[model samples]
Target chain A: MEELGPLFVHPYQPDQFWILILIVSLPAIVASLYVLIRGQLPAALSSSLMILLPLVAYLLGDIHLMDESKRVNYCGSCHEAMSPMFETMHNDDSTLAGFHYKRGAISHQTACYSCHSGYGLSGDMTAKLAGMRHMLQTALGSEDYPLRLRRSFDIDSCLDCHAEAKPFRAIEDHRELDIQEALLARDMGCTGECHETAHPEEARHGAAAFAEAR
Target chain B: MARFAALLILVSQLLLLRIVFDTTGPPSTWFTFVGHPLVAAGAVLGIWALTRRLIREAHEHKMAEREDH
Candidate 1:
């Protein structure tokens, strides 16, 4: 497994991070237990213990989970289906993902998510929801082997980071008004006409290479 | 109502704890989909219960003020 690295809270391992979160809510858990045993407590105290503390814990845990879910290791957890993508990221420098990985352009911890997830909170939520769907599909044994993205890749995910960068803007081809308009409108894919795709064409060669890549 | 809210909170917290501990790599489907929503639901119910109490107490306090007036 890849190191979770500085992307996760430091001074503690991943498990320890979660344990710390649990400890934060220990008071609420213990108080809830007490309430369950003794039947009731004073109204204000009860609200503070059962409502306020637990709500805080919920927010913290959920936010942490959301962060954790974006990690490359987390995405690669469905080993059979995702192993090729990982292999490609690690071993093949020809692909866009591998290029980014080799260059240290993206965090190793959040490599997959940096490009796949678009900008802002809406992007994060959309990615998380997609993650849940992937989990469900895997659980149901309904996932197509070597798995395909259900929707077209969002070009905005590319533009969100690269659109303003000097190198990206410096290319004369990139400055062409028609090309710029098409790229922004997503009429031209970032990888479509001129650039190497994020990964080798799995869809083109069929499932054999995908399985073998795993 | 308070007890029920507490129960929801407890159960949801346990579910979250399980997710935290069990999720080494990929999130567990049962925990992520089921547990997350349950936790949100628990928080919602807890806030609603607290708000209900506040509203009831405010109404009673208003009645007491009217009587005094």
Candidate 2:
């Protein structure tokens, strides 16, 4: 499979940016402590060095982390359960995710997030929180795999890109009013019988199969 | 307060570094639950300490002026 470049190619990107922050912060923290203990610097200056800088850095790091959580590798990391989904996305031709990945319809780097994340800021936040929950579950050894979504997939996410496209509208079934309503209401799934699953069958069978094979 | 603030900042920084490098790991979970709160607490304490020191300096300078007079 063709590979995507690293997510953090630029200095401003999260991986590099955080490293830069750590470099500046580590030594500055030491110096700030020394000056603060000696009472050599003004209280305000020492406070800014010790408190304000770290606070700002923390906020910025959080923003970067949120961005990083959107990547496909991030989803694949920290859990064996997610490996098959990544595998299917990469190699399985019949699945929706694979088709998209092979065709360049979605970014390979952020394919999982692109399809799964809901639309708008609130949706983005919800997806990020869900990612955090997954990490927590992994940390606690509480995850039950074949990982399931917290809720049904939102058709609006599909419609956000496909709803108005010429090819999407040209389909006869999609033109039907009730079918459209059912899709909008999520009574019908876009990836149901007609389109099939976004991932392969094994992707839904959890890590047990993968573990058994191993 | 100063020592406590330093400790909190150090811990928070370490947590953040762990999150940055090993993002999808158990340490990231620790960061989400604990590290963020520590940074907030550290900032509050540091500001409070600074305010107290400023007030003390002002009072000491005032007393010195009065004694000279």
Candidate 3:
């Protein structure tokens, strides 16, 4: 398969959009119509079916929504401001996000959500809300240039996936006593000290070039 | 209103599918414009409906009690 491109920048069209629509809509439309045409179901059954059918529809719809959100194109197209970051991810070079994604440490699909998503109760909701804020900021042109994150990336966010992996722990310096302490302390240097950051060299250079050109 | 709000939720979600998954559309569009607004609108409508339902239920109970008296 061709490498996934940014959501909106595809040279060719994909059918996933329609597939999503069909998956979500077909069952719903069918179920609603069935209930409408077959009026006067038993009261108990009517109430149950009314709730159940919509729940089923929601369940299926959400599953497809989750699946589609995993696509790189889906996220990149959502905000033009984020497009540069997507470009950085897609380019080949060993950088923090790019390298891990390319190395398969992160999912090829859902890369954006995987790292950014919160891990505990309401984690997904929190992440999504934060994402919404970013989107809104981007849309309103209120976001700062280069788009600083609210805070530095959390060490826990990295450790969530890496904390258990033998290879992750086995990295040479990461195994050092002080280094381990720092990692636990959520030291910013812990990650960059050994493993690279997610951006590729090309991306870095591209940023530099843009700056120089300016 | 509940029904309308519920429909909005479905509509918004469907619009999001196009925004998120449809690559054939023009590249310049932020499909979220369609999807996100729908979500907000749906939330507002749903809340309005729920409150209305509660008020109606309370009123119905009051009337029923008055009839008994």
Model 3 lDDT at residue A160: 83
- Over 4 Å off in model 2, which ranges? A1-16, A19-24, A32-41, B20-22
Ranking by DockQ: 2, 1, 3
DockQ of each: 0.33, 0.53, 0.11
Q: What is the Cα-based lDDT of residue A72 in candidate 1?
A: 83
Decreasing lDDT order of the candidates: 2, 1, 3
lDDT of 2 by residue, A1-214 (tens): 1255665342333456776667656754674466447743456566667777788778767876777778888888765668778777888778888888888788767888988888888888888888878887777778786667667887778888898899999999999999888877778788766788787766766666865654
Question: Clashing residue pairs in candidate 3, if any?
Answer: A7-A73, A95-A197, A95-A198, A95-A199, A96-A197, A96-A198, A96-A199, A97-A198
iRMSD, all candidates: 2.8, 2.6, 6.5
Per-residue alpha-carbon lDDT of candidate 3 for residues A1-214, written as tens digits (9 for 90 to 100)? 3455565353533335445456544554443345445532333443333334334444444455544554666667644455556766777535677776777677666788787775764767777577557656656666655444565566666778778989877777777888778766766443455656555333333344534533
Can you tell me the CAPRI class of model 2? medium
DockQ of 2: 0.53
**Per-residue lDDT for A58-138 in model 1, tens only?**
677777777777778787776655667777788888888999987878878889889887677888888888877778876
lDDT of 2 by residue, B1-69 (tens): 666777777778778778767777566677778888998897888777777888889999999999999
User: What C-alpha lDDT, on a 0 to 100 scale, does residue A211 get in candidate 1?
Assistant: 66
Chain B TM-scores per candidate, in order, are: 0.72, 0.90, 0.70
- Give the least accurate 10-residue stretch of model 1 chain A, judged by summed lDDT: A7-16
